[model samples]
Target: MSVKPEPVSALFAGSFALATLSAPDGPQFPALVTPDARVTDLRVALADEALTVRGLLEDWAATLPRLRALAAEDGPRRPLAEFRVHAPVEPRQVFQSGANYRQHVIDLHVAHRAPDDDRPEEERRAEAAEIMDRRAAEDLPYVFIGLPSAITGPYDDVVLPAWAEKPDWELELAAVVGRPAYRVSVEEALEYVAGYTIANDLTDRATVFRRDMPQIGTDWLRSKNAPGFTPLGPWIVPAESIADPGDLRVTLKLNGETMQDESTKDMIFNVARMVSYASRTARLLPGDLVLTGSPAGNGMHWGRLLRDGDVMEGSVTGLGTQRTRCVAEDAS
Candidate 1:
């Protein structure tokens, strides 16, 4: 039996407006606009309406014009009352990359390893010097995982869980898995990406690292995967829209002050390397989320932590920005 082609719709006025494209076969088509622009889940409308699409990222762009027209002419924008952003698909697990940025590695070395736990002060300094000498050649991507419970919506208020002592923010660019991957090479990694979104990989730095034993840096999962820890999205922009993921600007603001300001160019290990390395260890399935790691200037290293009423805003150029108000555990 032949499958029937599906019509795509944009949701508005508690109903969906059907969409149409100009050049349906072309790549990167424009979205139709009839009234306003607000999108919740690009996947649901495509599926129920029999839209001819593979994933959220691919389908959205392919039917862009039709969707845009619906947004512009159909009706006024309604408030997203109960909508929340989930991983574009249900991810098997969330993976994290560490020290992928050069500045991040350097900062970690100085803040986490320079004090030398096993040797005298003078000897430690000398060893640190040697470690610096090897930095250029020894650089490699580090990977970890974040718990599913840590995830939250883009604009949702983040409550400082009572168990956390030193909650910190790590602004990162995240890639959504599009297809099942196993033993993929760096060159073929991008093909698996559905789209990209912003991620704040919140950390509890005080309990994460041990100063006395520098070798034991921290527990990767525990530090980053605490409850209400990961805040993701404003929206997922298709990879086609991003000109260069490596060149995008990343910034973080805490209570309205800029903390981290840098470019993805500073990353020592890029996204492809992270995905390739991770897939080698285990199978990476559709919807698995990967965080590209954060830059320097997290709250922990500066002896600060998230306090009640602290607002955090983070963004990547071309992607979108997100703001979350911090509240006490009981108050939320």
Candidate 2:
């Protein structure tokens, strides 16, 4: 007989958010987080003890009703603070969209202009703006594959590689897929999204380009694939909970100062387009994330870069927050 799978969550409003959490030095399990910071262990509440966050996502449509019923009627639960929170879901693949924000790219063009190009600042800025307009009208998104091993918890420490001269943060809104999405259209893209979460797409700016082979272009592998480079979720806020992922505010604070504060409305390609564009090539499975690019005001834009002891706080509209401290690895 086919095994019945259950999800690790339930809700407060219409649905509850899912989380992967555990006690100190204990085995991780899926649980439903409440609005009051209490959580119900899905293992005890559901029929299958082996039910997991991923399994829940894999069968989202079937388990959704049960989730609602469970949410309305509470049972045994615990405080959220008593457990160590983890990345809400473990995905086999992660797709990242780059240079998708309108204003962010324009600022980068001005900031990283050629030394000899001494055109007036306004004239240069005007040129970049026109280029972005054209791209939005007719161009494919610049999407790249990110190593899932780079995933870490919301409160985890991000170890900055000693070799990295300029470490940067790109706080973005990540869409968590529920149904298997392959070659889905933009109109149907949101239908497959189960939830949304926060992601900081950290990059080693110094390693972005391969000096040895300029013609080969950007090197995302070396620039982004470090352990704990991508600090994901405190929890997965169900897509239904977020009325519009394309209109949320993506903000990041470095230490106590606000660094990146922009709206998803500023994106050249919205969440639906990004997810649809990515699925054109790859089969996005349950738990896989389609990371919508970050908004403006990156470290480079402010003439600042990540250093050891730097604490970053990032949050997306309804998806919750992630706080990761930068730790410089000792080369010697």
Candidate 3:
């Protein structure tokens, strides 16, 4: 497929605005927002219509004019459809990184630590450095092929697959590639970004295989690919709005309870560095997505696993949120 790249300036312009979702508190004033207000997933919006801008980032920036037009219309607006959402641009290959955050590293060590033994500060620091260096040498982006079957629209129900008993939630900020990026320097990496969105990098923790094996033999697939594993949307906010991709606020709630609350500042490998490293081998095509790692408070660490009656909620600062119910495999 010959993918057309989105304009860099349009996608990475540093401007962001919070989407107003709730109705006005005062009863007298007509709702500034309407009940039919619907958020569209980038892939879905593009497939249902020929976007004036071909690339995801450019299309997102291009939609501003259309949104203004829609707001001007006197009548009700239309809601987004399920058929329109693509499997978040299934790239030929995908990569991810492990222990890419200070918190993540500390959390890993803490989990492995014996309860009674508190390592001295200096000892902890030395151990952390060793762990980080080992992870860096692997140089393998902890990426997984986001299989098509595992993708769904923003509001769609995430049906747990038959074999999946350990569904886990990971709230993350996802980036869309607006241009062909290869071997780009960290300084020039952000230039290749198009926009950003909210994504829950859901995983089947039990399915994770041994990482010591060669890349193709044991990683990626087992860690990321599962039916309805990646649920994204609300909308791809133009990158220009976000002053810093690494500093956005992110959160994930389950069944109306707040689970993860943190800022992207905690990431050990910032966006530019992450992008620069991954593009060294494969060119990041337009529409390609990069999901920054999740925070420490995931359900997997705790004994609690996702059940059928649960509802999943994930969101980013400026980008809207994704709300989906988790239905058991047999129910569907």
- Superposition TM-score, candidate 3 onto the true structure: 0.71
TM accuracy, model 2:
0.93
Across 244-279, the per-residue lDDT of candidate 1 in tens digits comes to 789988899887799889899877778888788789
Residue ranges of candidate 1 with Cα displaced over 4 Å: 1-36, 40-89, 112-139, 210-217
State every prediction's TM-score relative to the real structure.
0.72, 0.93, 0.71
Top candidate on TM-score is 2
lDDT tens readout by residue for model 2, 262-312:
999999998889889999999999999999898898888888999988989
User: Candidates sorted by lDDT, descending order?
Assistant: 2, 1, 3
Which parts of model 3 are misplaced by more than 4 Å? 1-49, 52-95, 114-141, 210-219
- Taken over the whole model, the C-alpha lDDT of each candidate is 0.64, 0.87, 0.61
Q: In candidate 2, how many Å is residue 76 off?
A: 3.0
User: How much is the lDDT of residue 178 in candidate 2?
Assistant: 96
> Local error of candidate 2 at 296, Å?
1.3
